[model samples]
Target: MSWGFWRNWSIGTRMACIAMLPVVLLFASFMGYSWYSHRIQVDEELAERGRVLARALAETSEYNVISGNLSDLRLTIRGLVQSDASIYRVDIVDSSGHGLASVVSETALAPQRLQYGAPIRKQVIWINLFSDNGTPHITAPSDIRPPTVTTTNVGEVRVTMSPTYLLGKQARRFRVELAIAALALAASGVLAFLLARSLAVPLQEAIHALRAIRGGNYKVKLPVSTGGEVGDLQASIGDMAIALNLSKQDLENKVAERTRDLLASRNEALRADADKRKLIQKVNSIVEDERKSIAIEIHDELNASLIAARLESQSIAALAGKLNAATPAPEIEEIRLKAQAITKLTLDLYASGRRLVRRLRPEVLEMLGLHGAVEEMLRHYDSGSGCSFTFHSEGDFSRLGHDLAISAYRIVQEALSNVMKHAHAAHAQVSLVLQDDVLRIAVADDGAGFDPVLSSEGIGIIGMRERVYALAGTMAVHSTPGAGTEVGIVLPLEDRVNVS
Candidate 1:
């Protein structure tokens, strides 16, 4: 097919052009070297043959009787000349410069130079021989030039030859070699381009597929109109796209379902949270109402009854005192002991009621601030137990909100109770500090600690957790089997700390 101007000058052409450039330089070298080398080789062979003939002729002892027998010399020279195909003739001339015998055709003694393709010009060999005192010297025939040789006492021999046939054969061979080189070079260029395209095009297609995938077009398929490594790469890209598409579809479906499920679950969770808060508030109200009633009843009715018993004891003692001395000493002693026992029972009952009231609602928490209340509680604990507990506080306690105060007191109270019940602690440290807009409350005990994991279900721990959670505060209970228990809480005291 004929190539278009632009098409002829495509990548292949450029490649072919580039490929041809080296070949052209090599071909030029081949041309110069081949011609020079062939000519030199041919001349060397021809000159060598001529030297052999001259040696053969000289070796013949044609003595001074040469005036009689020129025939033997002529025959010997002719025999040597006839051995080579390129040698067309051999002639011996006597020292007097007269031709004795001619082995070459008279006309063939002079031939023309061989031309390559310029009209099958004659291919020739011209020869000249020199003799000095019956010794012969031979030089080969040459077309372009010849060497000057003088003789002494011997004859001159001239031979003509034709190398036209050999030249013709070489010409044909050179033409064949040229054609083969051209075809081989052109074929190699084409093959190289195809190889390059094979790799480059697939890489390009793979890149495009990747771009498409990046652009959210996961369905884009890589082209597979290829074979070998490129085809494998395309197939791999196809697999990747398929996987990406599946993953994208899966994510999309899950996202949709998750969105729906989250909405429904959130609604239910909201309702549950509201119900739970309501339930908790109701329980708190009921418990607080009951506590108030119980506190009032114990202080009024029960405590008044104890006071009445005490008054009765006093009256009995007065009567006993009035009776005095020897009137039924046993009966009087009995009355006195009875009065003393009544007074002791009433005091114990009042103290017991006060303990119950504090447990139910630490009234001191409201009356005194956290520090004072905690101090009082520690004093009670210290009196009851032989353990020394230290309390430290900072910031204005009165500025704390009511709810925060209660929760903090409760958490501290619960923590202390845990220490007393579970810790078997020797001593405890309660440090309350205000730092960075948050109150950090820490209760560390040097005691035989309990396992926090096992203790988590304990009521005191549960209550502490609930209180902290309600206030959006954090509580960390650190305890090891042997080391000790530290209950710490960081509460945001951003309440009405700036109270009027």
Candidate 2:
């Protein structure tokens, strides 16, 4: 079996195998040795017994064979065969190798048998001491031998034995040995089970405790019931849980403190941002008020002065014309020319004052509302710049508050300014939609667009963004290197006036 397979086995099962395998091997070895030894011993005993019986039979049958008493020898062999169940057969034969008598046992059932044979012999003696008395002593040494002894074969006996009885006895003994070995193996298994259970219980408890710790329950109670690795492990786990609990508590406290600090910092940042926006809006309002005052001053005082000068110049020019017509003088003509130049200069100055008033504060905005103002602005840009401009508006802008309208106009003005300055665009589109209490403004251009990220710091964009932010609106600029730039703005018209 693979080590991985064994490793996956439960501790109890592994321990049981560890405890029982060697015992099983030992028992098997013992049984094999016993069987081999017993078989060898049984075979040897059977051969020796058969040989002894054959030899005794052959010796006794010599007399019977010489006397020609075959009938008695057959009776004796038959009786011997009947007396021993191990003796399968017995035979007696004469010295000429002819069987004189044979008895086969009908009761012996063993398939294996052993055969032994012995020869019957007759004794002979010779005494020759007077012969060769005249022979030389050296040559005829010991002419009178102690006595010649010889034996002649008279008959033979054969015995065949079966080992069934011996095998049956050996089988009985082996059964007893096997039974004892089995009992031993069973006892060992029981002991191993108990031992494994003892270890597994603690291990399972450790696993449970570790699982609890992993699940963030560090308050588990583990009793140290034993001394050794298991007890040490339990104690260590308990300590670790306590330490972790403390660490978690400390970390939570620190997190709570950090969270409070972060919240305060965030509130401070928001307040600062709100204050900055308020300042910007206040500055813009003040600047607009100053511009309006300057425009009114220029329109009321400067335009009147220019108009009076133009009228005086016109009267002088008319007088010079009459004098020249009556007298036909070159001096009067020169005087008429100077008067005409003066009148033209005064008229140009008056026109310049009017244009300045419009630039300082657009009187068209108050007269025509936001839509008309935006359309007027687009027309101005389209006429001045080489770029084409398109203007589109939806919904009535009359409901818009004064501040929101001004801010919207300024935002659009700044956007168009940026487009004209940097976009190098062929065409630009401006859309203003007042819908659902929200004003959505989009300014798109097919121009040499710039990276919004790099150009975000431009004064024009920053001013536009600040104005939108002051009015609580959101503005986004989407552009790529080659693609056109589009500025999308969403201003909530409902509460926008309150935002400033």
Candidate 3:
């Protein structure tokens, strides 16, 4: 009845209706067209038949008209009417508009009857006789030609034909056409219903599985092999369900492992006070390893997934841009805006994840060695921190082992973090110098310095000192209330270098 009603219909019903409606309409139109076309053709044929009958009557009545024999003319007309049932009436009129002979049928005229007229012309017969010398001479027969040079029109003959037979035949054909159309429509409906059912059954099953998944049942699956969009969707959903189930299991296992590790660590802490330094270092190493793992996970999985989502959103935006939307439907523009916003948000999320991973562990530290890594860090801070940092280095830190290089990098990083968090200064500098057997580095910030005697060292400063000590190095903190703070470290190069 309406589009809304159709929308409420089940998929099977809708599909059946959609499939059969066009077929039924086509069959009906074809039947009507066939009937109308046949009727037009039949009418044309009947008119032609009437015209031919009138012409023949006019030709046969020529002698009757010349002889003024009304009886014979009437008999000819009656004979013609008797010959063809459709010939309802015939009339012969002289040139003076006087009717000489007429014959009428007992049948009543049809609603739309055929009438035709033909003019009667006197026909001349020329007799050719052989002369005595075998030459030809022509003679005309009597008053029909009267030695005239051309034919003469004597009168007009009119014939009227009833179209009752044509109508009857057309009615019979229409009935046949109706019967055929009905049969075809019935067959098409049956076929459409079967096809729709075939599609809908599998599709309904897939839909049920989707609903189960929505209800948090990841075990639900559909093995429908329709080999179409539905099939692809089914496969994708099944894969997603399995993947989600695995992830859920993995997460639960991880939580249990972490709980056990926490209990073990608590016990170890209570049992070992003399090995506090070793425990602290071990904890630091564990934390660093976990950070690296987390960063890798974020980079590998989260970042990739976000980037993919962003690209998909961008593709959607591009497609939307290409669409013709001179006059969009309701909510179309809103949807377009939402798509663009989603793309933007996805991009933001990807950038943020990358920044997080970079902060957790600088990949450049592994790629370009310690010198390049420290320089890159300073450059990044100089650009982002609103404070100018000048870095100066002497000798190659790249020659150091990973542990030594990483310790140096961490000290510098901690010093910078202190500057950024506590320093109310605009200028900072970092120095890495290798002189003789010792490696020296200092990070100094021109800030409102705190009196080292009265101020307590922050965790960052303590951590840096511990790192320097763990490397068997000495660290110095120099600061005054008015002047800037300088954090410096010195390490012997013997233990850090490997000859091989």
In the predicted model 2, the residue pairs found to clash are none
Q: For candidate 1, lDDT tens digit of each residue in 1-500?
A: 55665564545446555656676787768766776666666666556655555444543523421544777766665666555556656655565657666675332333424211101111234454544455566444644455454333455445545554345556676777767776776676677667666666677788889899999999997868788877888999999999999999999999999999999999999888767656664665576668868988888898889889988997887788667555757788788878878888888998998888787677887899777788888888888686789999887677776666766776788888888888888899998887677878999998898686675567887777666655657888888887888988888876636475
The digit string of per-residue lDDT tens for model 2 on 1-500 reads: 66577867877788778888888898889889998988998899889889889888977887788888889988988888888888888878777888788888898876354579999888678855444676443425645446688999987888888888777888899899889888988898789888778777877888898899899998888888677888898899889889988998999999999999999999998898798889888989998999999999999999999999999999999999999999999999999999999999999999999999988899899999889999999999989589999888899788888888888999999999999888899999999998989999999999988886676558998898888887778999889887889999999976654332
Query: Which residue segments of model 1 deviate by more than 4 Å?
Result: 1-183, 207-221, 224-247, 270-278, 324-326, 434-437, 450-457, 493-500
Q: Candidate 2: where is the Cα deviation over 4 Å?
A: 1-21, 56-109, 120-150, 154-156, 319-339, 452-456, 496-500
TM per candidate comes to: 0.63, 0.80, 0.43
Q: Report the lDDT tens digits of candidate 3 across residue range 1-500.
A: 66576767898998998999899789978987988888887789779888898888887888889999989788777876777767678888889989888888765366244469999998676553654478774444642433334578999998877777777778898899889789989999999999899888888887888788888787776685787886787788788888877887898899999989998988886566426656665776777788799999999999899888888887776666556266555466666677789988988998998889877877888898778989999988788678999989898665677666766777788888889888877999999897786889988988988988888988888888777665667989999876889988998777676444
- lDDT of every predicted structure (CA atoms): 0.70, 0.86, 0.80
Candidate with more favorable, higher TM-score: 1 or 3? 1
Error of 3 at 492 (Å): 3.4
The full ranking of all candidates by TM-score, starting with the best, is: 2, 1, 3
- For every model shown, the clashing-pair count is 2, 0, 0
**Candidate 1 vs candidate 2, TM-score winner:** 2
